[model samples]
Target: MGQPPINSTGEARTIPVIEARGVDHYYEGQGGWNHALSNLNLTIPHEEFLCIVGPSGCGKSTFLKIVMGLLKPMRGQVLLEGKPIEGPGTDRGVVFQEPALFAWRTVIENVEFGLQMQKVPKAEARRRAQEVLDVVGLGHVTDLYPYQLSGGMRARVAVARAWALRSANLLLMDEPFAAIDAINRMALQDYLVDTWMKDRRTVIYITHDIDEAVYLGDRILLMRPSPGRIGRFFEVNAPRPRDRSSAEFAELKGLITEEMHRFSSENTSIQEDAA
Candidate 1:
C-alpha cells in the first residue's frame, strides 16, 4: 500500500478524491518497450493540494493523464470519487502548459466555453465564469482576447476556465505556469493559491520545480524513475500564504530537492554502467 494521504495536521483524510491501485503503464518507443509507470499506488484526499515532483520521465505526467482519463494503465485501475475512470468526463478538468485559449474568444468567453459545451444554460455559465474569474483576479479583463493578454494573464484565464466547471470537482494541472517568466510565474502561483483557498478542489499539480512544489502543495509527492514509482512523500506543514523565504520552507524544499538529485544521480550511474 502507498502512504495514505494525510492533511497538514497529519491526520488521515476520510474522503478520497482519487485512488490509484497497482498502476503500471507502458508504450512502444524507438527504444522498444518503455515502462512509464510501475506498481504505482496513491490516494488524494478531498480538496487537497497535491504537488508531484520528479526528474524527467518519472511518470508524473503519466499518472496525471491516467487521473484525467486520457490514458489507461495497462495493469491497474484509477478511481475518482470511488468510480473507475473509463474515459474523460465532466468530473475532472485539465489545464496543460499552454493556455490553449481559443484565439478568437475573449477571456470570459473562453472560460464559459466548457460549461456551454456541457449544455449549461448561458446565463448560468456566464455567472460561473465571472465568479471564477474574480477568484483568479481576472474579472477586469474578461473581455480581452487571448493575444491581448500577457502570458501570466493568459495563464490565469486557463485556470479560470478549468475552475469554472461546476461539475469538475478535480482539477489536474500539468506545469501550467512552466512557460512564464520567473517573476510572473511566482505571481501566477499566488493567484492559484488564492483561488484554491476560496474554493477548495482536489488538485494534482505536476511540476519540475522544487520551490514551486513546496510553495503550492499541501503534500509533496516525490517519484523515482527507471520505472517510475513513489519515492516518498513530504508534508508541507507551513501555514497558507506560505513565506517562501522562511527557514521552514527552505528546509522542506531542500529536502525534496536533495532526494530528487539523488534519484537523478543514481539513474545516471545505472545508465553509465549499462553502457
Candidate 2:
C-alpha cells in the first residue's frame, strides 16, 4: 500500500503523535551561553514521516535530542502523547548516523539487545528479531558479526534492530544515511520507504540533503542556525514512489535550494554587519 494522501488542510490527517511547544535549548560555556534551539514549535502527526533540513551547525540534532529526552531544554516543553518527556523511553526508537553495533555480537544478537533489556522471553525475542531481519533483507547474515558485514549491511542491521522493537511509536533518525555511499544510500532509502509503508510508524528524520528530505518527508521543515529556529515549512505534494528525475521533483528541489542559498546569504550579511 502507498502512503496516506496529504489532506486538504495541508497537514497530515493523522492525530498529533508528538508535540513540541515553544521548545528552547541552551548550553552554558566558559565564555557565554550557546543557544542551540529557540522557540521551536512543531507537531508531528501519527504515522507521518517528517524530515528536518538545515545548514551545518543548525540544531537539527539538538532538536532530536530534546525530543528523545537526552537533553533537557532550557525553556519550553516537549510532549510525547500529551505527557512531558522526562528521559529516554522504549516508546521511542533512535537510529544514529553510525551503526553503533557491538563488534563481538552476531547480527541477530545485536538486534535482540533492546528486547533483552525489556526482559522479553529469549525465544520470543529471537523469533521477532528473525522476522525483522527478513524485513530488512538481512536474514542470511543474521549469524555474522558486525566486522564481517559490509557497510550497507551493517546499516541494515541497525535499522532492523530499531524496527524489531515494534512498540516504538516514534523513530528519530539523525542523518542515518549520510555516511553511506551513493548507491547504498539510495538502496537504503528505498528500503526505508518500503518498511515505513508497511509499519506506518511516525518518523522524524534529520538531514542536510534536500533530495533526501523531499523523497522521504510528508512535510519538510527548514531550520536556521546561530539560534536555531524554524525558517520555512514545505508540504511535499508529489505522489509516492516519487520519480526523482521527473519535472515536479526537480522543481521542488530547485525551490528548496534557492531558499537555502538565501538563508545562508542572509546569515553572512548579518555576521558582517555585527562585525
Candidate 3:
C-alpha cells in the first residue's frame, strides 16, 4: 500500500496539486447560453483520490474535461501544479467509458502507441508498456488483439494503456467501470485501489454510484445540477479496505444518500419556483 495522505484536518497544511478557481462553462443554445458549471472552485491535494458525484447533467464529465484541458472553460482556470491548463498535456491520463482500444493493435502495442508518438525508442517503449500492463493485470494478454478480449479485459487494457504513459501524474477516470458487469466492476475497483496504493497517482473519478464514491474516494464531492456547482465535500474517515458489509460503511453511505436526496429536492423546488 502507498503512504497515507496528508490532507487530514489535523495534519500540517499541504499545497493543492490542482486548483479550480471560479470555473464556469457554457454552451450556445436556442434559448441562449446554457450554463453547465457555475463559478466552481475546488482544490485537490497531492496524492488524493477525489470522487465527483452528482445527478445527470450536473457537468461532472464537463468539469473533468476542463481539468483534462480537452475543453476550455468560458470563464475561469484549471491549474495543474500551479500552472494554468492550456490544453491536453502528458501530465494527465484519462480512461473513458469505452475501452477505445485499437482493433488492429496487440494489447501491449496499443499501450505503446502514445510513447511511440513522442518518439521514444521502440525498445524502451515496449519495456514501459509491458510494465504497466502487468500492473493492471493485462500483461499476460499482451499479444492478443482487442477483438480477442472480453469486455473487462479490454477495459484493463485501456487503463493499462493510460498508465503506461509515464509522464502522467494524475489519472482522470470518467465512469470507466460503467460498462462492466457487477463482479468485474468490483474487481476492477479493487485493482484500481491496489494500483493507486502502489503508485499513489492523484485520481479524479466521476461516477453516479454512491457506493462506489464512498468506497474509492478519500473525499467525495456532491454537486448540484442546473448549472452545476459544488454542494458538499464529505471526508471518508474509514480505514482502507473498507468493509461494505460493516455498519460504518452503511452509515456513511446512508448519510451521503440522504444529503443527495435533500440537495436534489431543493434544486427541483427552486426550478419550479422560477418557472
Question: Candidate 3 — which residues are off by over 4 angstroms?
Answer: 1-15
For model 1, what is the alpha-carbon lDDT of residue 166? 73
TM-score of each: 0.93, 0.93, 0.92
Model 1 per-residue lDDT at 179 = 94
Clashes of each: 0, 0, 0
Q: How much RMSD separates candidate 1 from the native structure?
A: 3.4
**Residue pairs in steric clash, candidate 3?**
none
Q: lDDT score of model 1?
A: 0.90
For model 3, residues 2-28, the per-residue Cα lDDT tens digits are 453554375743556799999999978
Between prediction 1 and prediction 2, the one with superior lDDT is 1
Candidate 3, position 2, lDDT:
48
| Stretches > 4 Å off in candidate 2 | 1-15, 29-31
**Model 3 reaches what TM-score against the true structure?**
0.92
Candidates in order have lDDT scores of 0.90, 0.88, 0.87
